[model samples]
Target: MTQEYVYDYEPDYDQLMADIETLIQEGNLEGVRNLYETVHSVDIDEVLEDLDDSSLRYFLFMLEFEDISDLLENAEEDLQIRMMELYSTKELIEIFTFMANADVADLLGLLSTRRRKELLNYMKKSDSNILKMILSFDEESAGGVMTTEFISLKQSLSVREALLKIKDIAPETEIIESIFITDRQHRLQGIVDLREILVAPGYTPLSDLIEDMPFFIYAEDDQEEAANIIFKYDLKYLPVVNQKMAILGVITSDDIIEVMEQEHSEDILAMSGVSKDEEYDSTFASSVRSRLPWLLVNLVTAFMASAVVSLFEGTISQVVALAAAMPIVTGMGGNAGNQALSIVLTSIARGDMDLEDDWKLIVKEIVLGLFNGAVVGLFAGIILYMKYGNIILGLIIFASMIINMIIAGIVGFLLPLLFDHIDVDPAISSPIFLTTTTDIFGFFVFLGLASIVLPYLV
Candidate 1:
């Protein structure tokens, strides 16, 4: 009997594109606007990028300000700038008011300095002040990624009043997941979500409606840590606060996702010794500059490994078998070390493990390496024994494999922690350092064993 095959579903992108063109030809802005809202921002951004400036602007104006903000956030910088050029200062300011403060600041920073200043003058004072505050922080910090447009309510307000207040501000604020409760001095007290307010009696004070103190991060906290907080609590938005407990802004889950993706990409690139964020659209000269430092580092490490090989020059000259087997030992050990290192790096990044637990992870990996080494070494020793009928030669290869592999596992675990202690990125340095150590050690162990055990073979 034959089993039926089932396939996963797919969306019709060709049909969607055709429909978009049909709507455009009919000059139906409402149909285009509706279609834009239904699609994901990433797809909408791609479609918008394909349109001429005039058509893009027409679509942008037709969509709600919220939809336009979402599309702009996901689009490439060049595309966003092109879209911005079509809006007048006044029209841009109007739309800017509706955007979260961080989004507004980011867009402003992308414009020419003169244009930024001119646009600032045209924007509402509150909107301008919020953008200025967000812009003041480094682009990679929590402050730079937060929104100042969260709803805040006085502790004295009754549930009914707070509900009315939220309704009044809902149209103005970027996020309404939580209503922050503040005291007379505008100090943070507690927070309540919309559901809590809706369920409570109208006459009940906000203090009674409040939940326990909500999770918050300082404006100065690293943006990466802020992302971790969101993951820990499964929060929709985490609050940013001052030393005095005055609520400043909010870091939303959407922003956290973007930050995490960029950080992971940076780590992966750095692991290959490349400098951070090598732009895909960069010129060849720019790309070369970004990668040159890493290539030089690899060259230095390769020479160090070659120096280890030089130490065994006499053994290789005496025994052709030693030279033939050296690459297998070193290459396998290096590969094993890298696999263990990747697991440790990912665990650290996910906050599932840390330096404090290093010993436990090290022991576990070492045990795994020894188990693997025994199996691989046994196969290699048996093959050598069968081929050359030399028990001594087989013993040398088996002993060398076990020793080198065990060393590889321990060194791989320690190397990254050492780099982290020295204020360097461990992921960036560990691979190069571990690879060099494994190669040198593997050569030394294999050749030294051969020299001592099989003098006749050499």
Candidate 2:
């Protein structure tokens, strides 16, 4: 079997590429299928994505139903849709049945409405109903992201009976880390780990075997909250329930990891002023459209900063040195502010910061900003004093530096909070808004201070 060709049998890249080319050339369906069976599905998915459409279709048709299902589970959404289009209704239903409900819902969402309806009509009634139930929730909610195929046992059953029931149901369920215990009303009571079932006396009731009051998440809770609970408790799986304590489904740790990774990627894209769905293969026009709005916001803000500089044109012509040195103050303050803002925005996104704690964080940043400003400002003042031997010019730059830094820090801290209060993304606002504030204020402070102080020294 191809599984025998383990990681230790690493083929050289050129040899591996050559083998792929040969496989494409030979076009023997069975041989290509056997070759794919040797590698993990994730690796297969990557290889398939890299291949041109013809090679991908050839390799996909060679694989059996189980392998196709596994590969499709990890495939890109576009590829999944493409493959679904190729499969017959019966073949599609078989592969769809093998998928977890969360994955099914996601795949269905990516399909055209007409195709989605046609595919749903082909599914078993129970499977169709369950998929519809999952699809009803918002994609980011716990209900939407969870699997409905979790194992549940009645609290009255004996451990022996439970084991027999599990043997009957095991083939239908995937990743049975823990069995949920429910009451007559189907309200969740507790959880029994697989280890507990194995070790318990045959006559022990499930109520006795089940761990009392296990950790769980509400179905309406955000999916990230479910992920957080799993990560915090280091659980392999977590049960999802409704307000009445009736079990809904389970969120596997692997599923949570996927959600967290996607969320992190989306947040990074948002910070870069791109849409969440932006792809590397997207057309140039699409990429431009995604980034243009932010650039426009920045352009308007840039002109606003320039207007501040324009206000000081007289100050600029009088002292060319002020024009030369002003940007240094603003640039350093902007960098400092951006660094602080990035940390604060991350903390907010990760749910580490609370509404009440905003003041404490702001105060802490302001103090750090002042201390850093004082140190940097002192050095700047000494440099000016050495160069010009003018104490007024030195004092003017030092005072302006301190003022700009303090304002930059305030702008950084307050801008994120303001954005958060209005439900705007803080990361999107922090750099653009904070930099604008720092530049305009920095110019005004340095030039205004120089104007007031220049007569005394000159």
Candidate 3:
């Protein structure tokens, strides 16, 4: 009987680090290579990221050139730049050759102009030209992320000829799920999946296998727009065409996934009043710089809310309980407003809601606010009455709570729409504005009502 040895696929970061340390101390290059072979590329990349600078440099230097190239490609942008700095020009050029042109261009774009020029001078003319073309597009555009290494065949070719051509190019191309069908002028005509070609008769022309018109995006289109189109169509590879409708490159699903992740991260960070570039491992100065501006803006809004409270200071002096209860109104309003803000922002991001639905959405939120306020106000009023033994105070708080909640819903729904209209990112600026409105209105309503009913309470 043969015994099967099962390897643990789950990543154990500390154990892996210790093992690597032992291997390095013993100078076991073969053992390190064996360890690399056992781990998945992404897991290896994670392990490399966890290492200290010295350990990272040593491991990177000891690895095969191909392994280093793979690691660079999978690494974060900052780490890729660091690894690029570590390698000599000749070694960098060799590593670049193994990487996709899009990734090579991305790494080179991060380098200083002098360094980029020196590296570009060492690369082969053809590879340099490809990198230059990719660098020409904005980093957030489809052309920047798209790869030139896609299988394209003339529409005139027979299935057998197309298959042979694909076979020849398959070794060089990264994406073979779909073969782009182009005209003599290299204009995109249609696309045929490789499966269709495999099942079709060899005598069938490639054009016949194209079930529908080619769905492609322009090179200049925003990467997010491209990602949305790919998501909408459920495509694995989306062709990028030039202004003349000629095939330029292809954006794969993997690229779209990366874009989606980045956009999500940016949106979440923006909502929290932090810069998109500030990561968990960012320098203290960088993090402070990113967050301080927003905090300052919030401070101004806080003062504004404070000014509203000052208007009813006389009423508060008569009844100190009003001061104690003030936070409840403002805090509840803030929470309610945030809920509406989240819904509206998510709908806008997904393209489910637009400015045209502003009135409809605002009215719906206000109605929801009214219902929620009534429920919350009922319990709050009962609590206030029990605590103060004053029915008048209870009724005053109940009315104030209801009015503040209504204000919360209205302000929350409108702020994002208004920000969108002014071309400001709703995610970044909406929370600042929404919280201010809720705080100001919550304080104003609660205190104004108390002032009006002060005689009855005393």
lDDT of candidate 2 over 1-458, digit per residue (tens): 22233333444445444555667777766666666666667666656666777777777777788888898988888788777778887888888767787788888888888888888898888888888888888889999899887789999999999999998888888756688999998899988898899899999999987677578888888887787778777888888888899998988888899888987787788877888888999889999999999999989989998998898787778777777788889998898888877777766766666456677667777788788888898899889888877777778878888888888887877787778878787767667888889998998898878777666644
Better of 1 and 3 by TM-score: 3
The lDDT for every candidate, in the order shown, is 0.80, 0.80, 0.85
Candidate 2 — which residues are off by over 4 angstroms? 1-18, 386-391, 456-458
TM-score sort, best first? 3, 2, 1
Task: Compose the digit string of candidate 1's lDDT tens values, residues 208-317.
Answer: 87776668888887888888889878988888887888888988898899999988898898888776757777788888999887789889989998998888788788
Specify the poorest-scoring 10-residue window by lDDT in model 1: 1-10
Mark the 10 consecutive residues where model 2 has the least summed lDDT: 1-10
What local lDDT score does residue 28 receive in model 1, on the 0 to 100 scale? 74
Off by over 4 Å in 3: 1-7, 46-55, 213-215
C-alpha TM-score for every candidate: 0.86, 0.90, 0.91
Candidate with best lDDT: 3
